[model samples]
Target: MYCPPAFREEELPALHDLMRAVRLANVVTSGTSGLHASPLPLFLDETDGPYGALYGHLARANEQWKDTPTGEALAIFMGSDAYVTPSWYASKKEHGKVVPTWNYTVVQARGPIEFFEDEGRLRGVVERLTSLHEAGRPEIWSVSDAPEKFIKGQLRGIVGLRLAITSLEGKRKMSQNRSAADRAGVAAGLSASARPGERLAAAEIPQG
Candidate 1:
């Protein structure tokens, strides 16, 4: 991901929090066929690795896993996003030079792609994914909620994936390049909008 200094996100804790809050991620890998991407719910295990590890699964027949990746694959986690209209900038009223843009947070994790179909590993992947999304619900679901035989049979139809993340890049573009008054305008404009993500982005404006 091409990131400029003004919009880059470099904090380790912040990056992990962004990834975890996003809930889902896009895994992209270049192959002989073409650039392929799979969007799936991901869970991270931050035990020992420098950047921890990523875990997820996809349909077994998804050819993304068929050919070994010749190099690093990228996993992208997208955070709160909002459209910033030109009217949100103070420059629009002064010099009238500003144009519409977008503000968002994103994290790109690149690493060696690893594939697994062993039942144990696959089972663990499925369980963690389920728990990550289902937690805090009134009636949380468990992997064991389904019949063991049924889950085993279901697991056979998909492939589990793990990436020992080697490089992690992130960016949070929330009108940081704009003047304080312009950014305040953006926050006020977005806060009044009904879009959930816009409201979220409205709160991320740095105190610059």
Candidate 2:
């Protein structure tokens, strides 16, 4: 991520918060064949390591797990984002120098990747991931809710992955580079937008 100093978010807790908020991540790896990527819903275990560990599963048929990865794998988690129009910038009226840009938050985790087929570990991963997303639901579902034999058969069709994070990069481009007046304008504009994403992004902009 090409992040300027004003937009860089290096705090570990903040990075983890972004990762936890975004359920899906794009897991990318480079192999002899080439680069392969999969969009997987990953759960973060902050206590696993210094930077933390990510757990997810890939379909057994997905070739990404078969190839030997050349280096550390990357997991990209994207958070709230919105389009910022120059019309929302006070500078646009003052000097007409402002151009449109995007405001968003994202976190990238790089780590050594491990793929396993152990049934017990796979079941644990599945259950943990399920619980994370289903926590606030009216009716929660569990792996035990299904027949054991059926669940076992379902697990056989997938492989579990654990990425022990080595490093984390976070970027929060919420118009931090803009003047205070311009930022306030952007926040106001986004807060009034009908798009839910835009409204969510409005809260991320720094008031100071």
TM-score of each: 0.95, 0.97
Over 4 Å off, model 2: none
Off by over 4 Å in 1: none
Q: Which tens-of-lDDT digit does each residue in 1-208 have in candidate 1?
A: 7899999888888888888888889999988888999998888888739998898999998999996565788999999999999987878889999888999999999998888899998998898888888888999999999998998899999998898888889999998898899999999999999988789899998756
lDDT of 2 by residue, 58-175 (tens): 9999999999464699999999999999999988889999888999999999999999999999999999999998899999998899999999999999999999999999999999
Task: Report the error of model 1 at residue 160, Å.
Answer: 0.5
Clash pairs detected, candidate 1? none
